[model samples]
Target: MYQLIALDLKAARKEKTTKQKESLAKIALLHQNVQSLGNSINEINQMLMDHDDCKFICITEHWKSQDQIINYGIRNFKLASCFCRKEGKHGGSAVFVSLAVQCLERSDIRSLSVVGSFECAAVKCSLNGMNFIILSIYRTPSGNMHVFLEKMEQILSKISDDSASVFIAGDFNIDFSQDSPNKQLSCSLLNSYNIQQTIFQFTRITSASESCIDNIFTNISPFVSNVINSSISDHTAQKITVMVDMNKPANAVKKRILNNERFLCRLKSVDWQNVFHIPQNDVNEQWNYFSNIFQSIFEQVFPMKTFKVTNRFTDSHHPEKIKNNIKECKDRLDVLYVISNSDNSYKPCYNKEKSTINY
Candidate 1:
């Protein structure tokens, strides 16, 4: 599923003309429901590698605790802000911004409203000279829609007075496909603040139907807005592109990659028996001796070499044959689903094929 999305992004980039590429500085915003980011970290990394311009990624349903937040960090990006459910282990929200972008959590706004049955994380940042307040939220399936909207009204009311552009994207759990009262009220409330939803297509896909529950709303007009067809999760990823000034100077940083094989070999070669041998008279002397030996080994084994970072997207290491196999699995599942609808004998076959896809 992730490989398919990466391939599509690569193909899209290749199809772009030189003129279109050089027109303006564009930042892409991506939102997804990574059932558990810890389990889908590789897929998220592949998506980021494929779309380097993605400056902000809003993730819902992270299913992580406060102490486990560090485990979901993405390379080259900073975890700007996150909100985890206090009572349960299921619902959570997070926003990751590129290291090049200046971003900070908006605790003042977050403090103004209490998240009763929903999770939300917001960040204020400047990207390519444009200031924005981006929010990532996840509303539970059984959460009260009216209560959530009331809190949203307060947040938007406060932010509407500011000049910085506002973007609120998330899985609100309101099915836009049906003419439900909650959907109508949500749309009307957004309209009152002159905020337009950028995502028009359905985000969640299934064998039987689809829905537009995931959305991106912003006050400023974006350069482009579309949904990326992916099976990384039940919901497809929504991407929004906005143009910014390209004349701003860039801040580039260098990072080091340690040689783990050499480090491990050096550690294994250490004579632990001799290192542990110490004078029984003074405990401080024994501690100092061990510390010195450890420091010396670390310095010799793990020397750092700096490499300057660039705006180049790396290709995925996943093989083409494996991607073809995944595609074939999806095709087989679709065929089985269609057949099962008409013939009762195909129901078991559909279930077997579905289990193989691991969607």
Candidate 2:
């Protein structure tokens, strides 16, 4: 669940209301280090309060010290660190999750220190039972720009596998177009990992330069549904709506069936009861037994097909467009066997056999 606000939030600063419910997850990547943050934190907190139901929050290039973070908890959100509290103008990366959601797991809450690199953190969490990985990235000043980008690509590719969904968002420092030094490297990594890239326009910063440095990319799992421009910061925040399935029952069945490693391990672990246990069964026999078990499990879990929008974008204007986009994203997820809902999470609709209407 990633949504970007590509503007300086300081201008429209307002407090959160008691009755407002959060309907989206927000992620902000800012270049303003702690020293220059001004009143942005307050502005951001106010915005978060508005969308109180949105659980997760991630911010890159956070220049604040750990003491400051510990003393004040970013209004209502809990903060996680990925960098040490160094003195005097030193800034790195940090993450924030809402107080309403359960704390699951997080990556090395330490800064990814490279010679020219800024701050970074890799976080792992399950939103409404859907798992996703987020990386806060920063670039350096020295070395072959291409080589630096290549290293970054290597890191992303190494972490992303066929099993989990991955999202990397932060200040890239360099653009992704052909003229940019790391364009090829950026394109190669994104193409290989199937990540989404977006640029937002900010008029307040860079005088009037329309720079597109900040980016958001994803691999597998919840698909990117949209990207929105912001009026909060000098840089445009990306609003990415990730499509996640809500049918938990069917998802459980699919997880057991599709997880080849786990499934094989389970098969090896199963012991025969006192009567008529077959040994070293052929592939077909094993498959038959597996299918029967799966069928029974599915019948118990998913008795009917249900459509629930688990993840979505609040700023998105078109409902039909968003629905269609979500369907497409689900199709991609089905191919990877990563959709969360066991029944509606799979392809061609889970009730094909009992479907009353013809295609």
Candidate 3:
């Protein structure tokens, strides 16, 4: 049974390639510097369509306003958390989590974010009986490196947990492919926290330049990652896979006392004659007596009920379920994105998808 969460972004059916689709461990992630999420929403959707198992989406340079991001999001996945520029028209970050996972936004870490130096959005994810923090970060090429390093340390210090892992993904604009003062200091800072840069392949490829500025940093063990050529920008994307124990109750377990018509009827059915005929003549004392009686009946009428909460949708492997949810997901997409960036509203941020080929 393949459980699902996150956006409803799907693509037309295609023949499966040699890509690894099934895994003994189920947690998978996809990271990209989309240039502009509004324009690249379709591409991002299509990418998730091909790699349907990817539950986490980390994006930098979303280039959308906080207002716009608040109004729109992908269908199946929850737009877990986001940070957009206040003054500038570009440079922002977002973290999307699967519906099957539970995460808490780390605003304490996010409050430390600054525009030019360090911009980030982080979430503490609790999945499959494990806890970890996923941070999506971005820094400008000309941004202040000193401030970036300082804020990064504070952010790391605040979120550091002995029991939880930390995963950082971003376009830091510092080329790890070449030796430079910026690269050295950044690597040293991350190394201090035992977080190592994971992607080694050149992420950006142009006829004139090739660089590895886009990367993922982590201290997680038993994990594997690869560079994927996304035609979204000069910057390529990345995918990370980790096997985690799935037997534990992971998603979310919630319990509630059902307050239904039966409860209401039972409450009214109670013998309230005693409350009215109480020995106390004082009005306050009589009300208190009624309250106690009401409380006693309330507890009896409503009993605690527990259930495991899971996302309504499931992964593509469950073809029948996925197909049925497609229409329902699209309906939600329409309401969230009333402007409708789904098909025809996109303007190419860098290269048009039709002109560029992605794997």
**Sorted by TM-score, highest first, which candidate order results?**
3, 1, 2
- CA lDDT of each prediction against the hidden true structure: 0.69, 0.45, 0.67
Per-residue C-alpha lDDT of model 2 across residues 279-352, encoded as one tens digit per residue: 44453454345434543443343233323333321223344643443343333223223222222323443343
lDDT of 1 by residue, 246-333 (tens): 5533333222233444544554465645533665666455545544554465456433343333432112223454354334434332
Where does candidate 3 stray beyond 4 Å? Answer: 1-24, 246-359
Q: TM-score of model 3 relative to the true fold? A: 0.61
Give the lDDT of residue 73 in candidate 1: 79
lDDT of 3 at 286: 53
- Superposed on all Cα atoms, the candidates' RMSDs to the truth, in angstroms, are 25.5, 20.0, 24.0
Minimum summed lDDT over a 10-residue window in model 2 is located at: 249-258
Give the worst 10-residue stretch by lDDT in candidate 1.
309-318
Q: CA shift at 160, candidate 2, in angstroms? A: 2.2
Error of 1 at 115 (Å): 5.5
